[model samples]
Target: MSVGGGGNGEILVRVENLKKWFPVAAAGLSFAAKREWVQAVDDVSFEIAKGETLGLVGESGCGKTTVGRTVARLYEPTAGKVVFDGQSIYELPAEEMRQVRRKIQMIFQDPYASLNPRMTVGDIVGEPIDINRLATGEARKNRIFELLETVGLNREHASRFPHEFSGGQRQRIGLARSLAADPSFIICDEPISALDVSIQAQVVNMLQDLQEKMGLTYLFIAHDLAMVKHISNRVAVMYLGKIVEVADGYELYAHPVHPYTTALLSAIPIPDPGVEEERRRIILEGDVPSPINPPSGCHFRTRCRLAQPVCSEKEPELVDRGAGQKVACWVT
Candidate 1:
């Protein structure tokens, strides 16, 4: 695998105008038919400085996972740049890309489905270390044991298969695998979404502790606003394959700018029934438009209650407001 020099300064990962569009074929005769596409991630951009956690929040099917995958180079982008530790991954040779894998890893959304049912937990955790030639024999086994313990699982559990464990344990095993390579960055793709509600906080807290210990940078993708707020240093709100707002986590939560963002924040359930009942809910109108044929200008305009004529005529650029806050809307 090819290996480029480490990136400049503090930024560990940078994505520039990233786009991943899946092609859609013509239904019938294609002698002269034009190709169609599903814009999974359209012109999204962001950066993760070393040791920082950036939360990505959005409704289901809003391309949040696609952005994470595309940024990690799991999916070959249709257009855009992904620079890791100063190297442009898409521009690397196959072998070079393989080497880069050690520095970047991902924790999948479904804990049960993510782990290989046929493999023992020890083997699953040790696979990355083996692939990277980081350890072997007694050393590899020892490393696996250490990893299992690190993720809050007992060393004895390593010999068991994935099916023998519960949802949270499976996720811990998956996390152990990601850490096998001692990656500097991880894309957590809704890592707690499938676990029992009670188990979610344990995983999140474990991830936080691991991040602090390893000095890891993360792109945390999820729809759980409350969890995101607790874990993220900064947050970006995505809608219809586009980022509508990006700001400090607390700032964004306290003062959402875009109409879509406002609507989303409003839907988060407050714990106290009195407070929830007192707050006004902003219910958005209309369904999310098909990615294959999104609205002409701002994709969210179709459902935005405050959308104006200018929103349909031209796409609003993501402009900075202050203190690292940015919003893509005409009226905020």
Candidate 2:
């Protein structure tokens, strides 16, 4: 998922057989270090409508974040197509790709590291506008002010450095910078993972409001099932770089089919103490397989409780099970 979220207007982003692999040198210090490829993402595909929040959820190292970055063309894909607004993003020439930056943007996971401490908030927010030559003089200043205000900050904040703000405030500054270009699509890459629990709700609510006001598209990537359910129109569950299930949020929560999806949904805490205590917990055994040499057939078979002999012989395809729900497990 792109972490890009809502216009309900049209299909704005399509990822077809997207793959990203990082070549790793051999572990030994010998002269001949055999090359190995870490399959961060393997043939992941999805589509985001103009106005929708497609949540990509999974445990750490499942390539959920990589999927978002690849969709935005931040990391050059090893193979496959990332189509945005009817254009092939990776096929575009250098000049054209640079121009496309104006239409798409990303809010990174770490606000403290993403913002430059030396530059004032104004400089940080104005960088995009300056790079794209979107504004100049007081016009630029006014634009920066407007962006800051849009994110719940003030014009006075323009003079301060990143270190002057708290974690949540820094994140707000990051959000302001993402909107500096007035992008049509934004990838919110775990934007709330670093903030306080209380602050997370504030930021999420702000994002929802901004979507309504700007008609922006978002791919929201996170492991927080509750938050994803609240913000996303659809949700995808990924395991070992492959999506195992996807569907509308309500349908997914109500009737998850894949074993991995069921385990994930089972882990979400119920609101009521009595219900939470009574609900069954599906504890998955074993660790996630190494992506460099993932298990044959279904990558999730090793950890799935419902694994069968057929699971080791063929990887199930993600097919529609009904009601817009798709699952990759044969038993489901």
Candidate 3:
């Protein structure tokens, strides 16, 4: 769903009816015990145009990471089709998929856990180039240095271990590693969430700069609304396991239709104290329901103020309002 605008007329990624479920055995030892499934991603659909950044935002455990992983084919989806550059990625054979992965890469949330403690930054960044056989010898070393420099790191930092670098610098190294694959589409899974607030802006600015320079498409997953608004051309709000609303960054922030969206935007603190003091905050009553057994119909109905009886009986489809805002809600 390319909401708010159709974008550059060239779609790079299209995910339709995507569903990923993980089976878990019941606690009982009996063979007759029923198995349950964790519906990580349920019928989620969206689109990303070439050179566009789509921000996916929600509270923690809303399945944002799972969606990104499934789109990248890191997780085997239980159902649905992921079409990238007009090709159905899930249908590809092993060798073809390996080749396709070169164009699709992910920057994970944790800078500390994602990198190897023992490996030097040089080895980590050059691993992708080695796997794809993109370069070797002096050429490879030069390429590594170039990548390091591209992400604000110098050639000297390449020889140091991950432990020697700060959180922001470590993230830069990870970004350089992803660039090593020469990917056109990158999934930034909360890449800045672990860093300090000051460092977050630097990373986001660097991402925007890289996107403009490289013509990159990103599925930026994060919980920071202000940062998302700054970097994303369009934004999609995810709930329990589904997308509830999508719109242009400005439109979504300015006029949110869904109750859930309104509540989310209300939580972002304003810079001006005058406006902040006058604004009304929407404090949701209950905690987020479990993904294992989300509420029937609308998953957010339980916490929604505008929810009606219909919201409990029928799940709303994401329908487009005027000016390209798409929302799934019974009452706006």
Cα error, candidate 2, residue 230 (Å): 0.7
- lDDT: the better of candidates 2 and 3: 3
**What are the TM-scores, per candidate, against the unseen true structure?**
0.96, 0.96, 0.97
Off by over 4 Å in 1: 1-9, 28-31
Candidate 3 per-residue lDDT, tens place, 1-332, comes to: 43433565588999998999989877789998889888888999888899999999999888999999999999999999999998999999999999999999999889999999999999999999999999999999999999999999999988999999999999999999999989999999999999998999899999999999999999999999888888998999999999999989899988999999999999889899999989999999989998888899999999998889999999998999977789999888
- Residue-level lDDT of model 2, residues 119-210, one tens digit each, is 99999999999999999999999999999999999999999999999989999999999999989899999999999999998899999999
Top lDDT prediction, candidate number: 3
Q: Assess the local accuracy of residue 132 in candidate 3 as a C-alpha lDDT between 0 and 100.
A: 99
The local lDDT score (0 to 100) that residue 233 gets in candidate 2 is: 91
For model 3 the TM-score comes to 0.97
Report, for every candidate in turn, its global Cα lDDT versus the true structure. Answer: 0.88, 0.89, 0.92
Model 3, poorest ten-residue lDDT window? 1-10
- Shift of residue 42 alpha carbon in model 1, Å: 0.6
Error of 1 at 70 (Å): 0.8
